[model samples]
Target: MSQVFIVTDSTADIPDELVAKYQIHVVPLRVVFDQETYLDGIELSPATFYEKLGKAKVLPTTSQPSPVEFMNVYSQILNDHPGSQIVSIHLSSGMSGTYQSALLGKSMLEDEQTAEITVIDSKSASYGYGLLALHAAQLAQAGKNAEEIEAAVLKLHEQRKLYFLVDTLEYLQKGGRIGKASAVLGTLLNIKPVLSIDNEGIIYAVEKIRGQKKAMERIIQMFEQDFAGQRINIAVGHTANPASAETFISLIETRFELGEVVYPNIGAVIGSHVGFGTIAIFVWPA
Candidate 1:
């Protein structure tokens, strides 16, 4: 039987132990603070990034990995596991150019090497598509081929629902990722914005509520409406906010039958855009 491997970017925000257990290959994106640069989850940890973010006068910037970087990781993977099939999943192309760079890297490979590789645009971000990559890796480990795994992932991508509540819209506004919700920014002073990625992978406001606690409940309500009576897997993601994440997990566990529960920390790159105290909940049928 042929072996299949999973590849994703640091923006996926998948937990380290799961990444290690699945042997998932993650290419790091660049996180820049003035002239200083650090790999997203590598040189800089999420806790450190949040600490710096709290004090920094200016917001940090992020950059996608180069095609050469992707090519190198892919080459290394194939080198170690000769003739293995690779499924490279990535952050939404609408949010970042990481997916396109992955495609270019695939193009740079030898025809034979390229043939065994599949590049996918997750059209989701944070642990939204992060869960997809994890599921794909699980399928790959179960002896599923790249085709079967990709199909399974894409199917879940369509069915999955993700919602995030930001402490403040300031980071998203400054980062220029506010998308459709940019209009209501100035007016939304104490109002928490509920955000989600649309089908095309763009961020948009799902709703705005008066309080943070209410907004979090609203997300669970939305999930209840969407996945009622279904067995599901849940991924709770947070940026320096575990209390809120645990609250979310507790609420979800009571509402649905869950298979797997994962706590994924929102890393530096995505954290830069969402800011601290942001909690994201991603759910799909098990």
Candidate 2:
């Protein structure tokens, strides 16, 4: 039987335990603080990245992995598996070029260096992408073929939803990920902006309200409205904010029937832009 293998980038932020359990391969994005460089999840952890961000003289920046990086990782995996296929999933193309790079790298390999490889743009971020990858890995382990696994994850992607709260818009503005004017205005207004990734894979502000307390309430309100009385799979993501995550999760458990709950800290690539005190929740059908 030809086995299906899974690969993803660091932005997925899938918990380390799940990554190890599923034997998923992860290629990392880059995070640069001042003149120093670090790999997204490897060299710079969420806690470390947030600490640097709090006191850095100059703001950090991020870059997607080069195609060569993907090619190298793919070559190694294929060499080990002989003829198995690769289902390479990644963060949204709207946010990074990692998906495009995965494609280019697969094409550059010699025919024998790797067998068939499929690259997917997850159209989500943080644990949202991670959940898709997690599900894909599970399917692959269950003896599904590459095509079957890919289709399953694509269907799941359509159902994926995320809502995040940012403590401040300064990092987003400085990173150029958010509109400066909007960031400035939101900051001045003391709005706890709620953000979501659209179907097209672009991050857009969903709503803006005052204070963190009300913002958390709004997230639950939206969740209850969308998936009420239904069992759901969820991930609660944090950026150096465990208490906040626990509080939000406690509220979620009270409102909905949760089938699976995963806790993963945001990786540096995302933290470089969103900064600390960021809590995001992703929900999908169980």
Q: Pick the candidate with the highest lDDT.
A: 1
| Candidate 2 residue-wise lDDT at 185 | 56
**lDDT by residue for model 1 (1-286), tens:** 8899999999999999999999899999999997799999999999999999888888999999999999998888888889799999999898899999999999999999999999999988989988899999999989999999999999989899999888887888988888887866642567888889998899998887888778878888998899889998888899877877898888778878999888899999999998888899998888
The residue pairs that clash in candidate 1, if any, are none
lDDT of each: 0.90, 0.86
Q: After superposing candidate 1 on the true structure, give the runs of residues whose Cα lies further than 4 Å from its correct spot.
A: 186-189
Q: How many residue pairs clash in each candidate?
A: 0, 0
The alpha-carbon lDDT assigned to residue 179 of candidate 1 equals 84
Alpha carbon lDDT of residue 77, candidate 2?
A: 83
As for candidate 2, its clashing pairs are none
